[model samples]
Target: SLLVTSGPPDSSLQIWQVVPEDSADVIKCVSAIATENCTGQPWAKIATISARAPWVLHGSRLNSVRITDVESRKNVYVAGSSSSQELSGLAFLDCDTLLLCCAEGQLCLADVRHPQILLEAAPIPS
Candidate 1:
């Protein structure tokens, strides 16, 4: 079972519903969505976000998306990328904090509960 980020402007994310049978290598995609943006490259890194409520965040590089967290009642979007670097990693530090690492060694922290509040931390040279 994998929640992978999809591409294009249609399906920004997809839950690679992997249903494993008896065989260890036998994995099946039970269901899948369409594409949305970002050249449709499946991102390798995936993570689940919990912000006082459960949130499903998924997307690829340069994909402007809007996710509605029904539990917390917040609209989350991909932070605008001012640089050429793409996102390399994503993690939820806590219920309200999210950490994003860019390919250009830029690390960012944001408040998941509030999309407008973000912090541009120090960059790590790659």
Candidate 2:
């Protein structure tokens, strides 16, 4: 399982492993740097090693991204613009699926089945 983290920079997201409860050390197992703009509230989900990473950036509007577990400790998922629009609210349908509402009235479902596959990128009309 992973710990989802949001808020720090303007639009940032990250994840860390849930260390065993017995450990007295506070060492973080994993951390993800935001590659894209998540310009608002950040969302995260925990799946198996086969599970995907689904996150949301919320503010003026909602934007979200879905990423598969092709690589470990990689935050290859991002959603929304870092400009005036803000995103918030996040949920996952399954290990390979994600759901969220954008402030721009956009409802999205991203498939994290394959990271190498080219996905259709289009802004949902407000």
Candidate 3:
């Protein structure tokens, strides 16, 4: 198993590998990457690991989101929302599809293959 974590104050994301010990699980840092320096919030607020792909999607309290390749330990894509709302949630619908939610109740669907174009977006009802 793998675990994804973000460090506050310091802009960094780390991936850990879970190893099965005799009676407990031991985790070791497998890979890490530095995130973009957001002026206010330098740490990731939301993160999700893909089940169908070796990809990790994370976003800070800003409008930008990053996609990292676990196997290569490199950033594969970076996208930013046109809206100024802060990111609230992150998830993977499939290997290629991603779901993102904003603090202002907006939901966005994006395709990993084409990170620039948003597939769909709508406001969620209160």
Candidate 4:
């Protein structure tokens, strides 16, 4: 199994591999990648791993969502641009689709292949 984590203080994302040991399962960090254009900003408040692909999605306080390729140890795409709304959660609908939840009660569906296009968006009823 693999795990992805974000470091707000370091402004980086890390990928960890879990290895079975005799005594206990050992978790080791396999890769670490620095977040671009986010030197002073927090990296991620919410994150999600893709079930069908070697990808990880992270949402930061800057109202941006970034997708990282674990195998390449690099950012493959920035899913959405910055906005007034803050990200509250992130999930992978599929290998190419993502669900973004915002603090202002907006839910968005974005495609990984087309970062600029919003497949769908709606407000969460209060």
Over 4 Å off, model 2: 18-29, 38-64, 68-71, 75-85, 113-126
Top lDDT hit: 3
lDDT of 3 by residue, 14-43 (tens): 879999899998999887877775646746
| Tens-digit lDDT track of model 4 for 38-58 | 676645754556565577777
Write down the RMSD of all candidates, one decimal each.
5.3, 6.7, 2.9, 2.9
Candidate 3 global CA lDDT score: 0.72
Best by TM-score: 3
The reply for model 3, stretches above 4 Å from the true place, is: 20-24, 46-53, 80-84, 124-126
**Model 4 stretches with alpha carbons more than 4 Å out:** 36-52, 61-63, 80-84, 119-126
Candidate 1 ranges beyond 4 A from true positions: 1-12, 16-36, 40-44, 50-54, 62-84, 124-126
| lDDT tens digits, residue span 1-126, model 1 | 444444435543444545666775554444343333445554534466654444555434423323435344355555544443456777778766667776666677776566765577875455
Q: How many residue pairs clash in each candidate?
A: 9, 13, 0, 0
Relative to the true structure, candidate 3 reaches a TM of: 0.76
lDDT of each: 0.53, 0.44, 0.72, 0.70
Error of 3 at 37 (Å): 3.7
Candidate 2 lDDT (Cα, whole model)? Answer: 0.44
Q: What number of backbone clashes does candidate 3 have, counting pairs of residues 3 or more apart or in separate chains?
A: 0
